[model samples]
Target: MSQPRAGHAPVRPRAPVIRRAAGSRAVALGVCASEPSHEAGAAAVARRLALPLLTSGTDPRHCTRLDALLCLDGDDLSLRQTGRRAPGPVRVDFGAAAMRHRRAGGHNELLGRAVGVGKKTPLVVLDATAGLGRDACVLADLGCRVTLCEREPVIAELLQAGLTAAARRGDPWLDALLSRMRFYPGDARSPRVHSDPAADVIYLDPMFEPRDKYAAVKKDMALLQRLLENSPVQSDAGQLLDWALQQPVARVVVKRPIRALSLGERTPSHSIAGRAVRYDVHVLRSLN
Candidate 1:
C-alpha cells in the first residue's frame, strides 16, 4: 500500500530572516609596504582586535575582498574604504586645522557655556558617548578634566591612535589640552564610570537619527552610521539618558537635535539652543 501523503500534515511557521546592512562587511587591518615602520603598530592592533592583518605589496585600493581597511598610513592610523569610489579615510585627528580654528574662535562658545566651563570653576566632565572625542577635546581645551567613555572598540582604537600621534608631536598647546582628557574604553552605565570621583558633569551625546534631507551627511558621520548600524545602543538613547540622570553629578548635559523631542520624553530644566543643535541641561544641584 502507498504511504499517506505528508502534505496533509500541519505546517510550522517560518522564522523571520535577520537582514544585515548593504555593502561589503569584511574589514581588515592593513599596513602599507611604503611604510614598513608601521607594521609593528598595525600588527599589534590586529592582534588586539583579532582582525585579519594584510601586509606585503597588496594594495588596499585594489583589494576587492575587504570592505574597509584600518590602515597605518605614515603617521596616521585611519579607516579607509577599499572601493574605487569610496570617500576619503576617516581618523580621529584632534590637531586638525578645523579643530584648531574652533579652539581659536573662542573654543566653541555655546558648548563652553552649556557645560558651565567659564561660568564656574574648572569642572570634571564625563562624556558618556564620546564618539570621536571632538567635544571632549574641546572641553579639555576649556580646562575641564574630561573623561571620554566609548563602548565601541573600533572607535576607542581610533581615539587611542589619535592621542598617541598627537602626543608624539610634542606641541605644547596640544599636549596641555590632551593632558586633561582620558579615554575610558567601556560602557558609561557601568559601575566603573559611576565611581569616577571627577565626574561633576555627565554629558550624553547619543547618536541622533539623521535629519537632513538634501544635505549629505558628513563623511565621518556616515562612516559611524555604517559602523554602528546594528548596534543595540543606537536604539537605547533614552536608557542612556535615564542612567545619566541617576548619576551623582551637579548637572547632566544632553546634546540633541534642534527640533527633536526631549530624550526619554523628559523635559530639561532649561535648554541652550544653537543653530543646528541644543544643549538640554538637567540641573541636579548647584555648581557652587
Candidate 2:
C-alpha cells in the first residue's frame, strides 16, 4: 500500500475495544492441502501469506493448534475452522444456486439502482471493499464493468481462485459476466486506483463491528471477522469514505446498516433504503 500524501495522513478511525473470553488465544491461521495434487498450490499460497503449510496427509480439522486453515482441495479453495464445533468452510462461488437464483429473478435491483446501472452505456464501477466480490459479481451481471479491490492477501487469494474456477467452467453466460470483472489485490485508496479515470461510480462497503452483539452473522462474515481481529491492516473507515468522496467520479455509494449513522457523519445527497441495509449516494454530478 502507498503511503498517504507526504504531509497528510489518513485520519484513523477509533479502534474498537475488543474483549476476549477467558483462556481464548489469538487466531492461528495456516494453509493445508487435502489431496496430493493440491499440495503445490497450497504450498504456494502458504508462502504468499507467510502461513504454515500442513502436508496433504494431515487432516486440517484435527490440527487443534491452528484456528483456521486455507485449504486447496481439488479445484476449489475454502477457509475452514479447526474445532469440531466450528462452522462450515467459506468460499466464493458465483455459480452457487443462490446467486444463480438471484441473477435469474432480477432481485439485485437495489444495488443496481444505487449505482445508476441503467445508463446509456455500461458504467465502470470500482468496488473499494470487495470482501468476497459478491456485489462486484452482481454489478457485472447487471452490465457494469466492475473492478474488485481487496487488500487482505488470504481473502484476495480465495476471491481470485473463485473467479478462475468460474472461468474454467466453460459456460457462455457465466463467461460474459466474468469478462466484465477484474481483480486488484491491493488498497483501493492507492494512487494507482485513482489513475483509472474511467470509473463513473465508486462503491464502498466499509465493514465495522456489528451493532447488535447477539445478532447472528453469516458463516463467511463470521470467519472474516475472526480474520480481521488478527489482521494488521486497520485502515480507517472514515478515511476510505473521505478518499472516495474526493475521487473524480459521477457519484459515490456507501453501503451501511440501516440503523447506523452516515459514514463520516456527512449527509448524502440521497439514499436508497432496504429492509436491513441502506445505500447512501453522494452525487457529484449527473450521470448524463
**What TM-score against the true fold does each predicted structure earn?**
0.84, 0.87
Best lDDT goes to which candidate?
2
lDDT per residue for candidate 2 within 165-212, as digits (tens), equals 788788897799888887888899777766664799999987765444
Per-candidate local distance difference test: 0.71, 0.77
Model 1 pairs whose backbones collide = none
Where model 1 places Cα greater than 4 Å from the true spot, the runs are: 1-34, 105-107, 210-216, 232-234
Give one digit per residue, the lDDT tens place, for model 1 in 1-288. 011111222222222112234443323334332365666666666555555667634565787765667787655778777778778888888889977777765437778777788656669899989987888888888899888888877777778778877887889988898878777777887777665556889898877754434224676467666666544344577888888888788899998878778888899999998777889999998886
Q: After superposition, how far is residue 225 of candidate 2 from its true place, in Å?
A: 1.0
What's the distance in Å from true for residue 158, model 1? 0.3
Query: Candidate 1: worst 10 consecutive residues by lDDT?
Result: 1-10
Candidate 1, residue 264: how far the Cα is off, in Å: 1.7
| Candidate 1 similarity to native, TM-score | 0.84
Clash number by candidate, in order:
0, 0
